[model samples]
Target: MNTPARSRITAVLPAHNEVGALPATIASLRAQTIPPDRIIVVSDRSTDHTVEIAEAFGVEAMETVDNAARKAGALNQALEILEPEGFVLIMDADTQIVPRFIERALQEFQDPDVGGVGAVFRADPPTGYLELCQYLEWARYAEQIERTGKTFVMSGTAALIRWQALKDVESRFGSIYDEQTITEDMRLTMTLRACGWQVRSPVECQSTTETMPNVPTLWRQRRRWYLGALQNITEMGWNRVTRRYIGQQVMLALSVILMTTLIGLTVASYAVNGFLGVQPFWLVIGAVFAAERVVTVWDQPWPRRLFAALVIPELIYALILQSAYVGAVWQKLNSSQGEWAHLGTPHKTTEEV
Candidate 1:
């Protein structure tokens, strides 16, 4: 009896002016337990030394030709150039995976129906309050993914995808990625599932990603993310694969509305009565909610867990995210194009992992 042949893995990192983060990212890829057979850095008009650094690491590096679609365009270019027999890893330039991430993520591919495996991402050491909030938020998301065994998007941060699945999408849709949508990862997720493929985000696959350092950058990052998700859902339309996605969006909108209404009523009541009104039943519910937050982030550092227990700061963070959702809705209604906010590279003074 002949043994089954193992599939070769190719990793494609899409970068734009990522000189500061490229070296560490490349090093992480080299250290993977099941390292990629080939590493390709797709440069999107990077003026910095991103290409030079990639070459220094002895990996294949290529530049995109007249590509204006950002990461998706660069990925499409890479997809067109290569014919891989197995899997392709689409990873952001800013993300660094654990040594065993590829090995573990690849395990999910044992079942032929699996189309993609996404990373459970953690923020790189946060330097500020906002970054810390993002870190906790990522932790909560990882916990949810672990519990549910469902994936909304094989995060653009890093995802291991089957080459055959990409081919299936192209055969049906004419292109592997819809460049028209800003969130190609979400669009691809919807497309793959629609075509009878399953996407998973297992707990064993983990990575660390950079966080926005300031308010403006965070706002832009989230606004673009929210807007991209909404746009992708609209473009995919209603189908068995997309119905859940649309439902998730509906739930999120309802959550925003509920939060706003609760806050408005609280404020109105306080204004009407000179002394603050307190409801014992609502306080009990709020305590349970805070306890749930703390439980979700219990694996994180004590500071973060304490922060979640406090609840107010996270409440503010929730409001910030909800505001970004509203902003995305406005952009969608106005048909405004979302702008990519290429985050600034970390300071040279910071030690690379």
Candidate 2:
């Protein structure tokens, strides 16, 4: 008779002063349909009650004294304690998994070839204008990854990894989450791909994270992300999978370049034809941007979804992100080392992360 396989799963939540969101995140894990065999929360130099809260829920909590790589360091410390033969999940403390996230994510691991599974991250409940914009942008990003049929980056917000793939990654980088890079998720994706491990994000494995409350914080965050992306690409070298993703980013960069060209053309038009040349270009751009939004936001409600088609907000939002991309390219060109700055999260009196 064949023996039934036991679910040897360990989940690690690396938190640094994340008291506001930790309670709910822990509660969701306890309520998982396929509950993790063990749940560990690593307190990464936390000054608040992150460890206490984890202990309160009967979850094992370990504190990291002074490891440098931030989240990556905390996670590596936790992984060392967890058994290697089991599957492991790394989740951001601010994120809350959908009710059936474990059920949905585990379904993908049955494939054996799938080494890592990521969740489709959504904003918890966007309250402000910028928050809503971020919501729409994330929804579109989730849609794009799903359509591509190959998810390159398994978000740091939520990802489940098979033990073997973690081993493969550790063998290459000395740590599952590399301390050498700010964007550990992207590096892990490249490493796993090179090792012939499949990574994916199923729509059903939905999760949510807090959005940056303001534009400045959002800019800083994205600037780091894009800069790290460029660093990873340059460091990893263009391979088959990385090439496809890089191609899209390169096109996005070109769009930024194209906008500059458009501005110059508009000036030339003013000098030659009283701005007549740029009007045609403006009309074409308006139609295309509107149409793009309409298609992308179809799943959203009516008027709010209609906002996706609006010229001003949509263009302004795109410009902000494009500016971040431009900033990233400039920083990368200068060999500037980037930092992880996920700021503007809700803070309690004790000041949570």
Candidate 3:
């Protein structure tokens, strides 16, 4: 099965009050090596100048009709209206793609079974310590995705998906996107693979997206993400497709617990012994952990490399994420729902991401 070289590609951006970030995102799409045949901005009850900004760029912009499902609902509205006959690119309104992003992603569709190609993303330049750590974290994740050629989830930041896959999901699940889930991309990805479609994250396809500016915001984002993942897998039930996802989540939880225990034991040992009196075995293990951190960010700038070498900064970041994961687990156990109110807010400036 082969898709034509010139098959149409349409881009759909689901936005909510993205007035500040919309222009650059639209500009990036316009500058793509193989720009989309149609660019549509589906606004989900935006109260700001989002629609005006989108129309100002000469791209089609329309508001969602009584949609309360947040981003997923907005995307569903667009798909229902357009019913695109070719590939559909779903991306965040704050994301900016490289000029050749669409071109590289489309190359994957050459295989008839390829349903989606996700982009490897890097965070925008850092303005503060939190942002810098976030950048390093993204860089490390991107490296892993590049090495494996397999992403657990197609990034909601940017992904090019086939029309056939969308149709198949709609036919089976009754919707292009599962509006009830907070992490729409992960759910769609699992559904595609469950239905025998190949989804990949190739090194050649890349994009840049905004990172959270502070800890509370970051906490909300990650908690919602993990909560959604847990809920999605549970809803999908224990199938062959969900087994790997469940294993991954369990490993993450165990790693967090192990790390916390290690830290506690180290602190206790320090209290019982002088600095030089601590055991050599713990020293060797600490050295290895520190080395791994440094190596992971070796390709980054000197400042970030130095940050990784310090080790403590990144460990704090990890702890923050672990705490968020625990909170998500608690929420899931209690049958509490996550909120979509903290969706991407516009940045202050229109600078390129």
In order, what lDDT does every prediction score? 0.84, 0.80, 0.86
- Per-residue lDDT tens digits of candidate 3, residues 103-198? 998888888999999988888999898999899888888888877767888998899999889898888888989999889999999999888899
- Candidate 3: misplaced stretches above 4 Å? 270-277, 343-353
lDDT for each residue of candidate 1 in 1-353, tens digit (9 for 90 to 100): 11124587999998887777788888999999889999999988888888898999899899999998877788999999998568899998877998998888877788878888988888888777898899989888998998898787888889999998999999998899998888888899988998899999888788898777777777777788888888888887877887887887899899999999998888888899966777899899999999999999988888878888999988888888888889889999999878775555444221111
What is candidate 2's lDDT per residue for 245-326, written digit by digit as tens?
Answer: 6886889888999988876887887898765543687688788878988888788888767788775786788788889889
| Candidate 2 residue pairs in clash (backbone atoms < 3 Å) | none
lDDT of 1: 0.84
After superposition on all C-alphas, the RMSD of every candidate to the true structure, in Å, is: 3.0, 2.8, 2.6
Error of 2 at 34 (Å): 0.7
Candidate number achieving the greatest lDDT relative to the actual structure = 3
Give the candidate order by descending lDDT.
Answer: 3, 1, 2
> Which candidate, 1 or 3, has the higher lDDT?
3
